[model samples]
Target: MHPHDKGKDRLRKFVARSEPAHPKLPLVHSTDAYTFTDALEDGNLEPRDCDVFIGEALIYTFYGRPSYRPNMNESATSLDHYLPVCLILKLSFAQDLKRIFPFDTGAFANDYYSTFMHRRMGLGDFALEADLDTPGRVITTFFGSARNYLHAAPDTKTQFDPAQFEARSYAALIDAKNSNAMDSRGSGIEIQIADPISISNWVEAAVVPSTFVQSETGDALRRLNIEILPYNVHSRMKPNEYMSTVTDACLTYYAQKGML
Candidate 1:
């Protein structure tokens, strides 16, 4: 067998015996209310220009909570100024889509900051140049939030080997305990979906702040037949603070797993 085939076979066996992380968790895509309203009007969630992944829509599998907040420290003129709308999508929605992939950390940071800096430095395409297959990306979901196990180097400061697919797969499967180490609110783990995701059949609900319930956007949301769940954003951790907490959690998880 070819060396690459051997690696894939090993990954297959590893995945067969691995415990999958929160497979049933509702994936949340947080956006500004204006964007959410536009999606509702269009009957689909269109991909925005992401600095890392280019033309892809991002969703966070943050266990049961929303992981994104836009300018949490800044006061908004209205609830909609910050990313106040959370579109909850079923995990199974991927089954109906093409080119859905999972990443252990935010894809842009994973590649731009850690993996292919040269590309970001005007040497090549800004998008990740990793030759990652869909199956390998799928395996990442099994070890979601356990960021350390999903990379050749655990520390974000270190450069990552884009070709070390087998190593990452092996590392994740070897430590099943960290598969669900998702206590941090901002786990930074994300899923990238191909552009123009039709949300009419996929999104289960839209969660927004209670103040938005009577807003114009709320009326528009109700017209779309999507359940609008009112949530308290003030009770949640600030996004900037969550960044620090996420870094600490990653280090703590790595230490607990003896990978630090």
Candidate 2:
């Protein structure tokens, strides 16, 4: 059988098996824009099992099917824009993800964190003002091994683990007043996802919106090239403690796997 056929067969079988238990469950067909868009339009809101493939390479396994819930979009507040709302993946494929993608994690750390230096600043301003052209003022941190992936200075505080990663927003400066000056992109804050995939994969991971990744230099960006976040993902967060809570969650997953 052809490769595409095999993938579809796998997806169909997965969905067939999942739907018997979860009638509302939606198994994503492929990590492509059209596939996700069509699923959403078809009201396939609850994603069950999905395949995440970059080009022809399957790098990671994203699990944690949302326990049957309604599409509660009516009461969603601005906090939802910045919270870790997506289903977490085990990232059992972390090594493969980095190997196949081959990015300069160091450059991202230097540009997003060290160059701006906001670790002690405490998340900076809740609201930031900036665009694709400006440096984001807010700081968002993830719990996975961003430092290790980027090969920056070792975290001296502790040994590197795939379970611990951190990244801040390098797109703008955080300031409520200045936030009003920037265009209304998502929540006007940089999103910090801890253990990005280890937590939960976004419902719209494959069909990422254009606004989520606004880069000018044409040099590849981690968000667009690697993470493949949904467009406007910044606007869908749960608020302050969400980051920490998710970090702990990712750590727990790793701990269970004996990787931490």
Error of 1 at 121 (Å): 17
Off by over 4 Å in 2: 1-82, 90-240
lDDT of 2: 0.25
Candidate 1, lDDT over the whole model = 0.44
- lDDT accuracy of residue 76 in candidate 1: 32
Which window of ten consecutive residues has the lowest lDDT sum in model 1? 123-132
Candidate with maximal lDDT = 1
Tell me the tens digit of each residue's lDDT in model 1 across 1-260: 21111112333343334344322344457666666777777878876655544454543333233444545565434334454566766545653322222233442243423332233222121112122233333334343433333332222232225554543532332333343232222123344454466677777667666667898777876776767666544443443333333333333433443533
Residue 139 of model 2 has an lDDT of: 11
lDDT of 2 by residue, 1-260 (tens): 21222211221122122111111111111222233333334433222322321133221222122211122223444532323333333223231121110111222223333333345322222212212111111111211132221111122333323321222222222111233222112112121111223212333223233443453311232433333434343454423323333333433443454543
